[model samples]
Target: MTRTIARLALAAAGLALLPGLAQAQKNAPHNDIAAQAEQVFRSSFRADNPKYWMTRLDQDEAMRLCSQYRDNPPPKMRAQIEKAQMATIRYPVEGKLIGDWKEGEKLAAVGTGGHIGFIQPDPPGRLRGGNCYACHQLAKKEVAYGTIGPSLQHFGKLRGNSDEIIKYTYDKIYNSNAFSACTNMPRFGLHSWLTPEQISHIVAFLVDPESPVNKD
Candidate 1:
């Protein structure tokens, strides 16, 4: 038991050390590279912009953890991180998790919010989108969708409308990290990338028989 415990500790230590060793072998100072990158990145932005936007370049706890593990944290740590993330999800207040799929279709198609050219964000009233097409193929009709995520065409046909499945899909879109510790999926809901109503509508698009997603 003692030997096994020692071996596990050494393995964990080695995993932690690996990235640093690689960084050092390049004869580069860690903070210097990071600071230089940040300087270059910030220089691209206008100084008149909101300070909060600049703050986003800094890492939060979750971002730091994922970076430390290279997005492959150990099983135990991953579960802990996921549990913490799951707690962040806020369900709808009106108990309405489904909305009009027509609205959702529009939301899914809207891709103008993030990191766009010269213009800064309009005040809070600006419409945001799921931008699902950027990483997911939603329907056969949309010939220009991305392939980063699994094809969601015929999603309803394959996965029936059950409370459990609906809830899982909702939560997955809300905070994908809850389902996949190192998922490439963005934390849409957790990051306010989408609202509950918006998410519900997207869910409707995925599950509604009359939605184009199902027809395609």
Candidate 2:
């Protein structure tokens, strides 16, 4: 009878622990995989630009939060992220939010910058490009465009060229996460990938009616 009673108590204890065990199993695999993947990535690449490449591995608060939520943070967290990112945007000193659409078009199309491979770094004097077409359909003439981002074919036509719209466009390009937290778009201005002047031009490319992006 004692043996049977002990067995019953053991079963009840196991049942009580099931919830904790299940929760641990659910969480541990994701962490384990992430750690393993990070290790592999760190080991795979030789430090071409040790300072630059190593910094990429380090996650800031925004990056860490985004990863924690899998790019879909809760509304409160999203708002917090947006608020923080919005504070980082820097506008041009000349107070011009728009520039030449032609220059903008060139910036959008040219996609070479900050490339690192094996032991090689990007050659100096190579102007950086937004490579916008890789993720967005801008000009109608570009036959090959990626669909990762929304089609911007009629961006200017639809939104029109208002002061508010222009500012929003420039800010968005500068720090996309400022508007939409955990967005896939790169923070061009925040990272210095594109200068404020370059971003202003790109804004013109999207908002200029004469630009091929808005033309049918």
Candidate 3:
């Protein structure tokens, strides 16, 4: 009986090895694997309503390329990816990319919006916040803050208010990925996560002399 049991275990291990050997012999294409994964994903989540959101699962040109290379493409690939992304960014047509710092401070702290799958959603008057403090240390007064990114306690003081500096700051806040490909920072303007006016305010928050970010 013990001999029979050992034979059965050996047979099971051989069965597993057969599949591994077969897979090694017949390698699946990357696109085929991705398509299979997407099918599995769609089957799991296709029941939900809001068909518009479902379309988001589809990848765009940049997203497809980014995923194809797992966000660490070669230097040449990185530059090509950045150039594709940079073409999508549109600067403010008015040529004035600054707004009220006070309002900007309030918006940066609110942190609400982008919630779905709810029955009776939030009221119409909800204000979305940047929650920049969640990933960055903004001011000296804010005792509790995250440090995923660099601190901006004295952003303006450290980087004086020059037109070029102001433009760079505004553009950085608009689409961080344009500057650094695959950056963890969200593309606030690219995704319409924040409006141009709101972004300008964020720029002001970082560049304005009177803002808390620059005050101390």
lDDT of 3 by residue, 1-216 (tens): 999999999999779646543553254247678878878987876465588767767776556656656766556556655766776666666877878888778777766876555466556667777888888887678867788888888988998989988888887887776777776677788888788888888888888999998897
lDDT of 1 at 207: 83
Clashes of each: 0, 0, 1
**Model 2 Cα shift for residue 131 (angstroms):** 0.6
Winner of 1 and 2 under TM-score:
2
Best by lDDT: 2
- lDDT values of the candidates? 0.79, 0.87, 0.75
Against the true structure, candidate 2 has what lDDT? 0.87
* Candidate 1 Cα outliers beyond 4 Å, as residue runs: 1-49, 116-126
Put down candidate 2 lDDT per residue, 39-148, tens digits, no spaces: 99778766555687678778876787688678887676678779889999999999899999999999999888788656566787888899999999998889788888
User: Tens-digit lDDT track for model 1 on 21-99?
Assistant: 4654354336566667768977887787678777777775567567656788767667766877888888888977777
Q: Cα deviation of 40 in candidate 2 (Å)?
A: 5.8
Clash-forming residue pairs, model 2: none
List runs of model 3 lying over 4 Å from the truth.
1-31, 119-125
Give the TM-score (vs. native) of candidate 3: 0.78
Q: Rank by TM-score, highest first.
A: 2, 3, 1
